[model samples]
Target: MTKTWLIYALGGGWGHITRALSLGRIAAKHSKVRILTNSPYAHYLNAEGCLVQWIPDSAGFSATCQQVRHIILNAECDRLIIDTFPRGLGGELADILPQLQHIPRILIHRDINPRYIAAKNLRSFVAENFDAVIVPGEGKDLPFCDLPNVHHTAPWLIRSDVDLPERTLTRSHILKVNETIKTILVCCAGQAEELPLFAEIALKLHQEFPKCAVRILAADCPPNCQDLWISHHPGIECLAVADVVVGGAGYNTVYECAALRVPLVAIALKRLYDRQDKRAQAYCYWVQDIQSAIDTVKMLVDRIEPQKKPLPSYINGAVQAVHHIMSYKF
Candidate 1:
């Protein structure tokens, strides 16, 4: 019999959507997959061959709850995979847990911060509800590390099909440019509010290092902040060729840089739940001020070597996660 999987990947930003896409693509090979999300990236999921149901951002609390309930009760998927938030984005899943208790459910609990640890009800809710919790990558100093049913795998990363030869070609092209011109890739997260800050940093870097060419990987740019912007470019390709990569301390970006062995300078952003500030400290260089970031980039641009180290063992989380999900008996 063909197994059916219903994946709930609700949250803001592209991280949730990308993770879902990575796992969903793999799961589709063995089982039918449908993604339930409210992210704008839902269209990308659809294009990538997963069945997607877009929950509008403007959806009210009752409507969101009803939609989730309807899908769980009617979709009849053999199992459920809930990503990130266990209580749903707006606590919509709380009302449907009783109906789903009999079904086999897997929760992808990425990481928990101090705020989450302080939420007594949230922790208790997850403990009582989920059959298994999969923590992608290395375990942090999180409160939920000791959960009996929790499983840890390699860092969950979106695998790229771009091969070594292609990456080499891209790198060669970048290096062929004038030796005096230094190329910097500014990779911001998919949040509009963060773009202006990055733009300012880019301008400062350009002003201080006049010989350096700073390019931003963004669809749109702020009015006052100006720099060469490439609206659409493959992230891995950009990372491979650039002299340095400056980005927010999101899990996906950090892991991508690590996997590619790029010289990374991370700027910790203020996220309500995800502890980017804490995560940034583990990387090569982390800065809060624009001036500090500029200085760090300048220091590392010439000294940093292209990552030649073998990919870390923890990066195989996608495959390991699929294996666990497929092997579990409902």
Candidate 2:
């Protein structure tokens, strides 16, 4: 009999859906997977053999609650895996998880705002309802690590090294100067409002490194950006060729950079749940402003070589996450 796994990935931005797809892709090999989300990029991220239940951002709390509650009662959902915000982005799932106690409920417990945890009293509620709580990133920073059945894993990224698209740079660009071509890839996949900020960095970097090719990789191409490569997810192929990667210090970007051993000059953005400041400090080259980002990029470029020395690869959380999720036999 084929099992069906339901994953709640309603968090804003591309991170949750991408991470959800990573797990769903693996789960789809044996079991059917349904990922419920509200990402604008859902159309581009729909995985084969897995269903994407797209919810709109305009859908208010009551409607979202109705939809999520109905899915929980869905007889086809053999297991439920929630990606952060256990109670939904705005408490939509507060009363939903408990209603489905018979089904095995798993939580992808990435770090969140400490104040929200206290306000929601999630510690007790999660401890009682969730059968398993997996932290996709480092669990050290999270306050509620003591929760029952909590497992620590690495960051879950959309694509792995082996899965990354082969070199996308042009032959002229690659063979330019008969040596390493200066390629700067700026990834801005989170909030669309921050596109200007990321674009500013891209422009400044272009101005600073006029001869080098500075490409902007975002959901939508920024205005006046000379070279723009648009994509719904992080630019994995571009990251492989980037001399210096620039982006916000979100979970996916930071770890993906580290995994590929590509140098990153990440600007830490303040988030309600994710502590990007801390992540920026720990994993990559941290910078405060556009100017600092440019300076760091320059420093990184100066030391960068055409051929990178092999370094140990970071653990891929999707593999480990699938292992844990699949272990709960139907």
Candidate 3:
């Protein structure tokens, strides 16, 4: 009988869903893989050929828990992979924890902020419940670093050619573009709350360097900044060929830029869970002030070559994670 795996990617953002898809693709080769998520990115999950069960975000905690429990019990999965939140976002997994106690539970624990350091109860719950923990990519100085069951692997990236075929094609088209027209890619976070700041920077950069092309990848464009907006998902090709990339220090974007060896100017955004500020400081050319971030992008655009470099071993995190999962005794 084929092994069956149920991946619980409970969260709001694209990060959790993307990570789950990356691992799910690998696991599908050896097992029947299905994803349970509440993310709006469920369509992307379906597109990747995984069976996705969408949990309504507006559903009450108890209702959500019942839905998840029903699915898991019915599937009779051999293994369970929980992404990010150990207790499930909004504690929806609490009800199913006991039911899954007999099976192997793997937690894809990402880096956390200082606030989580005081979450003693949450940490203790994870320690007691999870069979193994996988930390993706340069997750040094994490709260769970000392945990005996925790395993560190390369940064979890969703870069499979099968997952992002459009990006692969875009990359080829971008590579053929003339080098004389300099390109700068600005990726505001998914929320795009900082659209005004990005607009101001884009205007300044356009004025300062008239020959350069400024492309902003955002959900919405601010007033009078329509020319800069490039509404597209997974703008990896634009990032790959850009003279410089200015963006928030979100995990997926930062690691993607790094893997493509694009020159980056990462502005630390305050997030509740992931310490993007710390990650930016450690990995990229980080700046606290918006003005400094713009200045850094300008400097890199002038100095650095717009050529791709081979990703380091640490950035190949998804592969490492798959190997570890497949080899685990449980």
Candidate 4:
């Protein structure tokens, strides 16, 4: 009989989906795998051979329990992996994990380190839920080694099968907006608080370089922020035409930018589990101050430059994660 698995990725579903797809791709070779997320990127996942389940953001426990019931009845997965729990405005969703304890379940944490020290209450709550925890990324910063069943694992790299399309940089795609002399791609996580700040920075950057444009490739951004030269999209196809890319210092962005060989201006956002600092440290060359409005914009526009290293050979998170999962014994 074929084994089955369910991967839940709700918070910042783009990253979560990317990470989970890596595992699913690998798992699909031997086991039936399904991916669950609340992002619009769900369509991209379905085509990859994994069944896609769309979970709404901050869905209550009852709703999720119904989802679990469907999975158990139809797929009968042997393993259930959750990417993160108690996400912002998604805290109420944590109730579903504890309910899954009777089954084989694992929590996959990609936050460089779990935010336990600073987020005591939140950490304690999560500690009680799952049967095991998997920490991805360099384990240098994690503090709790004595915790039972906690496993230290490296972050899975992605490898895509889809070849990127060849396209020329359209002159309209590289217009000068702010006084900055370059086309900058804002690669943020699409959080609401940072959207306005990014838009303001883009407006300011346009003022500095009226001939340039600031393009945002994120989800859920507000309109009419900077009437100047700002545009938004949900894919990275345009990055092919950009001169510089502005984004937070997440692992996905770092590797993606390096893989694309695009110049970067990165801001480090503080996350629930204090993982931002370490992520910033890993990509320090392009780090920006998330708190300062003017400085943030300037850091992206004035200093953004090409990476010193050779472009990465691959950016397929799905392929890398899957390869590692298949090698995992249990």
Candidate 3 structure quality by residue, lDDT tens digits, 87-130? 77766676667677778898888887657646636677888788
* CA lDDT, every model vs. true structure: 0.71, 0.77, 0.72, 0.56
| lDDT order of candidates, top first | 2, 3, 1, 4
Candidate 4's residue-wise lDDT over 1-330, tens digit each? 888888866654467776676667667778888877766555544335577777665566667656645554454677877775533224544555566555566666555344454554655655676566666654544543445756664455444324433333233443333232366566655455677776666556556656556555555444554334333322444454466766776666665555566655666677754365566566534445544533545555565643233233554544544454445545
Candidate 2, residues 1-330: lDDT per residue as tens digits?
A: 788999999877888888888788878988989999888777766475689988886787788778777776765777899888878886777776788878898988887778888998988888888888888876566866876588887788666656654453321343122225677788897787898998888888888987677778886778777455545344565566666789998877888888888888888887888788888888989988888889888887787665334333556788889898878653
lDDT for 42 (candidate 1): 55
Range of the 10 consecutive residues with the lowest summed lDDT in candidate 2: 170-179
**Clashes in predicted model 4:** 23
Candidate 3 minimal-lDDT segment of 10 residues: 306-315
lDDT (C-alpha) at residue 184 in model 2: 79
Return the candidate ranking by TM-score, descending. 2, 1, 3, 4
Each prediction's TM-score versus the true structure? 0.85, 0.91, 0.85, 0.66
lDDT of 1 by residue, 70-117 (tens): 887777778888988787776777768757877788888876566765
C-alpha RMSD in Å of predicted model 2 compared with the true structure: 2.7
- The candidate maximizing TM-score is 2
